[model samples]
Target: MPLDEPAALAEGSSRLPTLEFALTGSTADYLIHASPDLLSKARAFEHWESTRLAHGLLPFARSLQTPPAAHTTLREQDGRDVRGLNFSSQDYLALSSHPAVVAAAQEAMARFGVHSAGSSVLAGNVGDGVALEQALADFLGLPHVLLFPTGWAAGFGVIKGLVRPDDHVVMDVLAHNCLQTGARAATRHVHLHRHLDVDHARRLLTRIRRNDPHNGIMLITEGCFSMDADSPDLAALQALAQEFQALLVVDVAHDLGAMGPNGQGQIGLQGLHGQIDVVIGAFSKSFASNGGFVAGRSRALKEYLRYFAATATFSNALSPLQIAVIHQSLKIVRSVEGEWRREQLMQAVQALRQALTQEGLTVWGQASPIVPVLLGDERRARLAVREMGQRHLLANLVEFPAVPRHRARLRMQVMSSHTAEDAQQAAATVAAALAASAQLMPQAAQTP
Candidate 1:
């Protein structure tokens, strides 16, 4: 059945029935259950999802009808093609469609075909994969690197592979889901410090060292958080780790190849290049490929992770084509062209942030590729997202479990290919959408 059309735009109107109903609950409500029957839980969640879908509020799993360029088309749930200014894709440097990157991929496909056919430890370790690993190690200023199928796997594998069950993990509270899951899988003594609070982390490290100095402690943080577009004090974290004799792991997934002077990401920007204990990165963000790597200072650590990391040992390795594309992207990232792209990307980010601010929207974090517009209420955010879609603006709505319950927002990912006009148009559309959403519901009723 087709979703019901959104209520007509009107000034000072009461809340739409659909919008009011969606505000009643969230995904978190269904995360846990007292029912022992697993099927019962699934059915209950399906019912809630169906209601959201029928009301045109289900924004997840949108299909891209075209390439995820600055301007693209998306297929809505009602089978309608909505063309808009796209800020939802993570192609930070816009290298995905670059001529050189595409040519390299074609050449790799011609030579190696499509599949790796086995795990990296087995038959999957192609010549191209090895070269890419070495190139990444050099780029990161680390002596050794190990490849994984994805960025998430890289984050999860490093912790799960090295940290023992008795070890402790100190992580930022706002760290990515992959890192959080990896810490939990590795040990039960996982401690979360306040976001970007170096002192809070020091206290935790102090407490952990006081209790169990013998067991290992792995400190984890990100170069740039995708949601909030913020970073922690890596130098301070490294100092804490050194004082406590712990290992500092920094995931550079969002910022690598997309920020910093030489595209070395936050580590280089913060003057900690080549000094970090572990540096994890993903290619999907800016490398024009889908893969991940863990770079470290010790060759023995690389060899151990290669054999021990289940995500790398049990899973298939990256294909030759992916390795080739990433290698080519890495080359561009190190060249003057990469610097130009980074400059353009930062310019776009600043333009979007300034435009959003000028339009009276609350922008989060500093100058970065991600521009999160704070929408305090989940109900307002959902309605605003629907309005954005109607106005031909494409962005992702993050809510509930991803962030605090009331702190829902629209995450706009900027790319180097986006022009100044694109930023202005996006900000204008966003402002209009928020206004329309507010007008549709002048007063919000209590949701039960």
Candidate 2:
């Protein structure tokens, strides 16, 4: 999402000398008013601007805006998409356009209405929402569940409700921004274990368990990492939690309906059903609806209901139509457990990874669904993404802070709707982009 993110290495290190490059002037009158450090920074950035101008690397994101004005599809872009495939978007399971899901939502809308006139605290909590929450709790094997308007809000509500400043929160290293935001908003002692490093996590939990066992100590992790698409070892982490006497809260945003024995997620997959203290996920992803939820035991749920600050509480509830669609989707996803949707999805990921790997693009992730092409330099990442569009492939770029600097990548998501041929075609488009980007920016790949 970062635009004009400077990649010094991508920009060519030897291309500019520090002292000379750092000596340019701005409106600040470098003749007498500037500190040496400030003058140097200005010059470096000024040199950066000059290099950008020379390479035509400057970008203006005219595509950004509220909906109505936005371009509807990559398909509509000129000289693009005669038949290139999409490697981006979180339409995992691809239930949005499913006929069954569509029909159920229509029926619910007929029975209930487009909008729930008030908040849940008022009269917005519809009958279908009640039933859906019950259905969710049953699937999760939890005693209670609460729905929220969005995954980010649900996460924020959970942490803000449970984690006091005195609390200690530990999470998997690569948790999404939602978890980090929620944790930081709730407490200060936020400790992150290396991605999937439960043993290292256990070491930190040991002290909290013994000395301040009852103090608020929460362990947060994702059921499936969105970017890398790898799953956490829930059974292992659950064991560590019991040993350390800490509460384990997991976000199944990516795993729900795609993981576990019956698509119930890692908690169910590992037989750690009642052991996990809390489970959270977005209804938006799996159900292809517009909300999120938190599930837990009665005690926790009741406490959360009292303290959780979900934006859904103030906003209109999921339209009865959306609730029905979600319920129907969940049921179908469960019933179709042995079907090719899941297998095909895995196959597609493997195929794309293999295809792109052969083409010399650095792809990361296991086959849980997300694929990130590690284009180490930011501008190369940008050029790769732009050329991907030229090849009619729709993918997104990830640059610094969403990832570390120089770890910029194109995060590709796999959807069940994508055919084997679709994935392969997508890979070809990305490969083409890779080759073109390499040729176009030879210096970028040459830097270490």
Candidate 3:
């Protein structure tokens, strides 16, 4: 069961303290104690149960003692540092430590304090939050924009705010979880096309329009699929939406601040700035800040979103410090320095992709930064991650439910700060770890 769903909490028990951490020994343990009824219904989760049991037979879950950085130190559960090259962070432009961005944030903190303390509809537009919104509007060539606390909230809140129960949303099968959640919450009629398949999306949209011509229709997709690290054809999607009289809502969370000419993202890459109906993106990736935005082609629609988008209206707006950091980051992203950083990032991505491929690994998707090394077998994938940690290389293990169990992979993110040497060494280390893990798999399976 999802963590948010109502579970069978102990009757008459006080609500779990909102300010406190709730730790359990395992997923089953947590579920059993927190929501036994939900766990009972989820007994068909064989993969989950099997993976949990296998963890005891192998090393897993290496602890990280610091915030994500290009070459940060990691730690074991016992607090010993693991010196390594980090391939887990999504700071693609290496701007998290940029002196200018940091200085802007500090200045905002000193001038405006920390928290916004209230929702935007109330009084949360602190410091230059509104100015940052306008700057984004001017940069994206959109008429207006509204900000949300996080990318997830922006994606979810926008869909729920715009569409109704009778409306239809045609989305990519591999759309982000928040997008899917928002669509499901907003409407009962939702259609999913194969990942990056423009033809399939067009067909779905056409069919939905034929049946529900008067109802609102939304064609949803992402500028870049984060896990797959591939992009859709924005021009083609825009044409299809225009033909069907539907809205084209593209979520550019992963690629907006990292790719394209001047870092304008996939929409800019495809020259669809004025063409796309709605643009949604996050500042967390390359912009060195938190919060996200929804850019629209019209001021009226943006005003509607400001008033109706649940996440924007109910949640507190971005902190003054966050806004200042984002404001400064955008200035950097639009400069010649930002272009140089992007070039370095692509160089690292291409080098790592080639090196990994030569090692007989199946690398998924076309290049844009995110590189998934497919391991296929869940047991082997987990063991490989553990072995990589032992080798002082940090990467993320993406497994069942996130991707199909058979397509389990190590989702490696390369940043501008990683050198050619870093990419090469990391690939070699990953290959060696995978090889060692494969050799131990049979032994591991036979042990218990």
By TM-score: ranked, best first: 1, 3, 2
lDDT tens digits by residue: candidate 1, 52-75: 766767777779988889989988
**Candidate 2, 1-448: lDDT as tens digits:** 1112223534445644322122112222223333455555455455555544334332222232211110124332122222345555566677777778889988877877677776766688888888898888888888788887778878877877778898899898898888898899888889889999988898778866666756778889998787776777888887777777677889988878865567776667677776678888897666777788888887556445534565655566666777888898888777864245666666777878888787777888676667888877665666666677666666677665568767777888777666667766777777787677766655424453
Displacement of residue 121 (Cα, Å) in model 3 is 1.3
**By TM-score, who's the top model here?**
1
Model 3 C-alpha lDDT versus the unseen true structure? 0.80
Give the CA lDDT, 0 to 100, for residue 226 in model 1.
82
Q: What is the lDDT of residue 156 in candidate 2?
A: 76
Better of 1 and 3 by TM-score: 1
Clashes of 1: 0
Which ranges of candidate 1 are over 4 A from the true structure? 1-19, 442-448
Candidate 3 local Cα displacement, residue 61, angstroms = 7.6
The lDDT of each candidate is 0.88, 0.69, 0.80
Clash pairs of candidate 1? none
Q: Give the TM-score of candidate 1.
A: 0.94
Candidate topping lDDT? 1
Superior candidate under TM-score, 1 versus 2 = 1
* Model 2 stretches with alpha carbons more than 4 Å out: 1-72, 75-84, 209-214, 310-315, 442-448
